[model samples]
Target: MSNNRRPTIKTVAARAGVGRTTVSRVVNGSDLVSADARARVLAAIKELNYVPNSVARGLVTNRTNAVALVIPESESRLGSEPFFAALIRGVSGALAESRTQLQLMLVRDQAERDQLTESVATRRVDGVLLVSVHAEDRLPGMLEEMGLPTVLAGRRDAGEQLSYVNSDNAGGATEAVRHLLGSGRKRIATITGP
Candidate 1:
């Protein structure tokens, strides 16, 4: 035994060979479950030290006005890039003005990516605003195919039919180069294509 806090309904379900819903009913003062099964789950919960996640409390109130903002990157990378942080601030500020909560999600694997896919397909969000999209990321493609109301912070590849807001990269570059030329830096070289 690791000697941690007791297990929760979710953990107990895994241990007792039952579904989370069954364990949840038992936990939420439901008398519908069979006494024998409930007892088994209770015992398993006590044996393991799995703390329940915040989902339990969320269930009682039946409210989670949270929107998941998925960013597929590492913490270090996120910190290094002002683009994501600024984008998030704008998104949060806009959402705050509308009195809606935002949930930031950082995808590190297929499971997390899949969750984003499900959210869009089910209209789980009033709208989804994607940022930092690569040229070949599959999530954006899937989201587009689902025809969900999505807004991208970056441009879609080639001919992808999706709604998005993008920075004026080309225009900004042009302005910068023109300024350099006017400033007598005629041999100035500008790097594009990230």
Candidate 2:
């Protein structure tokens, strides 16, 4: 093979004195190949510095091996909120263990939303993790309609049908108020966001 050409499966197979199918099986971690064939393929791969093309593998398997974390907030909000940073760190750490890629998407306007829609339509990600859900937001519905696997950080309402993870905000607030009242704070006020 020429030095200019990258090593292909066929080249590895030739070097290993095995068929292309045997090399493919070994590369893909299929146990169908005999031990001797597997060893030869491994040796050939190391010798040629062969690396499988992930794009080609994904096309053949119909899996992108990637997930999108979609946050519909602006960059300022994402940066300012400690919640967003912690969420990103947790998600990235989890995905790293599985060797999956994470795509962070910010959709603050119609243009960015349109881009997200295009990405989803193209099946660019295996799944989606959506954050900052609101009752009027149509993104969750759209993702459901497309049959994409989705999980939200919060629900739109009590009647939400999508999978979500949410904190007990009402319960926590009630507890806080109870604690304040018990401490004789008669003129306590609370601050909240819209």
Candidate 3:
């Protein structure tokens, strides 16, 4: 019997005839739980339509089920850049479908860069999505060395070892140029990210 009201740990616990702590442990994926108890908790959770509060669960298990979007650039660039905005929208849209939180990190200086590195090294985020890859950026290497699951928006011409997703800027540009040139344009100009 579910309504507009959301189910909580207490609801699942009561439905399972167990303590809230037991339900919490099960929801947090604690291996210490007994198999029989785990089954009951899972059944109860399903019956009650209970979705564990990730933030609350994060407090106990230290996994936020969240990802950090680390942009190593200026705020002005993010504000003015349509590419960044569109990429972020796509990222957030996809994440929202899965109920994941996005932590935005802007690294503008050496100190901020160091802080970002330390925070990631300390496991503050489950994963990281790095954007604005410069030719000589060190963050990607540092993140990879730390064993973090990282995705890059774009890579330098030398390419990156980490998984990444990006628009085919080069291919797109070439196609656009070909289109324009085919249409009888004598000159074409393209703007590329730095």
Candidate 4:
């Protein structure tokens, strides 16, 4: 093999004295290979530093092993909002366990929305996590129509058709008011924004 060429699965199989299928099975943790073959393949992989091609694997499996976190908001809002930061951290940590990649997408305008549509159409991502939903936004419907696995941070309204995870705002507010009343705070007011 050339010095500059990255080692392939074929090279690992050759070095391990096993077939390419054996190498693949071991790499994929299939538990079908013999102990001796598995050991040999592992050793060869370490020696050759053979990194599996994720793109090729995705093509073969028809899964990208990635999900898009679509935020239809401006960069300023994404940066300024603590909610977005926390949401991103939570999503990233969850996806880490599955060895899936997170693609952060911000769609603030028609052009950007079109780009997101194109990406979904291409099957570039396995699923989507949409945040900052509005009642009239058509993205959730579009994603549902495409048959892509999608989750939202919040619902568009009481009649939302898509799956979502949202905090119990009314319940939380009720609890807060109870606490304040218990503390003898007679005057209380609430503030909210979009």
Candidate topping TM-score: 4
Error of 3 at 92 (Å): 0.5
Clash list (residue pairs), candidate 2: none
Q: Report residue 112 deviation for candidate 2 (angstroms).
A: 1.4
The deviation in Å at residue 137 for candidate 3 is 1.7
Give candidate 3's TM-score: 0.70
lDDT of 1 by residue, 12-82 (tens): 89888889887777766589899888998787767785455545545674534455576877788889888
Model 1's number of clashes is 0
- Candidate 4 overall Cα lDDT vs. reference? 0.92
Instruction: Score each candidate by Cα lDDT.
Output: 0.72, 0.91, 0.86, 0.92
Task: Estimate candidate 3's alpha-carbon lDDT, on a 0 to 1 scale.
Answer: 0.86
Rank order by lDDT, top first?
4, 2, 3, 1
TM-scores of the candidates in the order shown: 0.55, 0.80, 0.70, 0.85
The TM-score between candidate 2 and the true structure equals 0.80
Find the number of clashing residue pairs for candidate 4. 0
- For model 3, which pairs clash? none
Better of 1 and 4 by TM-score: 4
| Model 3 lDDT tens row, 47-117 | 78799886788888777677999998888889998988997898899999987888888988999988888
Which candidate tops lDDT?
4
